[model samples]
Target: MQTPRDFTELSMISKTRWQDEELQYFQHALSQILPYINSEGLTILHEINKEIYTRAEKQDSQYT
Candidate 1:
C-alpha cells in the first residue's frame, strides 16, 4: 500500500502538463495503487484517466 504522500504527489502531477509518456507512467502507477488507495486517491485516478481519454480523442481526431 502507498502512503498518503504518494497520492498527494500524484494529485499534484495530475494538475500539471503531461507528456504522453509521463501520462502513461502515472496512469500505470495509479492502477497499481488503486486497490490500496483512499477515496481521494480514487478521485485523482479518475481525473487522470479522463485526461488520458480526452487527449486520445483529440489525437484521433487530428488523424481522421
Candidate 2:
C-alpha cells in the first residue's frame, strides 16, 4: 500500500494543465461508450465522482 509520505514526496506538475485538456482526457476516458449520451447523462458522472470521494474519505478515516 502507498503511504501518505510516498504520495507527499511526488513532484509538482511541470506545467499548468488547461481546463479543455482536462475535459479532453475526461471525454476520452468515456470513448468506449456510445456517442448518443448527452450532457444530461454526463451530470451523473458528478454523482459517481461524489460517491468515490465519499468512499475514499471513509477509507482514509479508517486508516488515520
For candidate 2, give the lDDT of residue 63: 92
Most TM-score-accurate candidate:
1
lDDT of each: 0.71, 0.42
- List candidate 2 stretches off by more than 4 Å: 1-31, 34-36
Positional deviation of 36 in candidate 2, in angstroms? 5.3
lDDT of 1 by residue, 1-64 (tens): 3222444454556444656665677678879988899997787778778888998899899999
User: Residue 47 CA error for candidate 1 (Å)?
Assistant: 0.8
Structural similarity to truth (TM-score) of each candidate: 0.71, 0.42
After the best TM-score superposition of candidate 1, give how far the Cα of residue 32 lies from its true spot, in angstroms: 0.9
Per candidate, the number of residue pairs that clash is 0, 0
* lDDT tens readout by residue for model 2, 1-64: 2222221231132112223344333344445463766785465345434545565688799998
Worst 10 residues of 2 by lDDT: 2-11
Residue 15 shift from truth in candidate 1, angstroms = 3.8
Backbone clashes, candidate 1: 0
